[model samples]
Target: MEAGNATSAAVLQARELVKRFGGREALRGIDFEAAAGELVAVIGPNGAGKTTLLSILAGISRPDGGEVHVPQGEVGWVPQQAALYRRLTVEENLMLFARLEKHEDPRASTEQMLELTGLTERRGEIVARLSGGNQQRINIAIGLLARPSVLLLDEPSVGLDPRQRARLWEFVSALASEGGTTVIFSTHDIQEAERYGGRLLVLADGEALFDGSADGLREAVRREAPEAADQDFETAFVAFLHHRGH
Candidate 1:
């Protein structure tokens, strides 16, 4: 759904997006938009096409139908898999990607990413030798090397411990709220969606079911299952899906 009526202000937009894998459809006529400096959470159960939607937005995949409009060469994508050169050190990996992205002054961008991602101390360490958290940090730092206007992360905090997850959120939240970068991330954690998402776009079976605030989602759940009016966010979401026969 459209985040707001101000479509001209949106930095990213997908209209009637459709994707299919073999006989099974992944996304169906999904319309989405995100304005500058907005933190949008893409949440749904497994097989909900959350990752598919992100891939399309990040320009990593093309939709079979519809269109996605974003500034060319200004989108950052962090997929579920680590896209780093394992044999290379953190600094080297950053430099390589910077050059690949044709970033002006690869050295300056590499150093900035190292410092911004708090990997300055570990810059010389091989990516294969770093912990999961540190590696994820490197992945994100590389995505940010070009100073993208829109950042798309698919399950970015998957393997991190609680402390690491907390730190990751702190950095991401500030990036959107203070740095004016549009951030869109997908996750199964409802609490994270409500806590970090300034806007939420929920998809089920490749269809967008809801798009708005956490409280707005609560109301949608309440309409679907009035008995769940007082239910917690996670429970309410489950009930909403169940009531819809999804």
Candidate 2:
């Protein structure tokens, strides 16, 4: 329960992380870490503890026993579900966070967020009035208001169509490649994870089955199942999961 050092070597990290909900253990002593400017994807099935891991790392929920190190500003988080005031305008939502975080100029910061998310034209539109994709952009903008070093997202592409999902991933890729923001996002879609994530962390039954780059993951799967080695990431990952007995 040490809040941990905000200036640690890794932007974010968890050691022997464990979390439980009554009788069931959601996370089982998983050790994880993210360095600055790295894009990591957490992949798992419905009950594989992906969201639980994200919430714990985001400091939204605590681990029953473990240590997590994060910098001063709260870790930016975009939950699977929207976390916004449906009645608030897009800019209004950003302004609320800007002021809450005590930004030097709330309006300026809010404007920057609007432009970043390509929501300037819809700044005055109520969140409930925007499409699901735009509402998600607001969720991400709010997360950026504090400029936290690490951003954690849960199923960020939940409601998007294939094209919209691709666009969102492109934006996220630029954020890491150009903006230098460390991002860790969870997704049930293995293909999406492999396509967008620079590194992959596979979790099954509350444990990390694999932690490495896409190519490394492919090699690992190939080593275990020669047939899958020659396949694409999606095929390899599915084999890897089966290898883990998920």
Q: How many backbone clashes does candidate 1 have?
A: 0
Top candidate (TM-score) = 1
* Candidate 2: tens digits of C-alpha lDDT, residues 180-223: 89989999898888889988888888888877787777677787
User: How close to the true structure is residue 49 of candidate 2, measured as C-alpha lDDT?
Assistant: 96
**Candidate 1, 172-214: lDDT as tens digits:** 9988999999999999888889888888888889988889888
Model number with the top lDDT = 1
The global C-alpha lDDT for each of the candidates, from Candidate 1 onward, is 0.88, 0.84
Q: Give each model's clash number.
A: 0, 1
Pairs of residues clashing in candidate 2: 6-71
- Which ten-residue region of model 2 has the weakest summed lDDT? 1-10
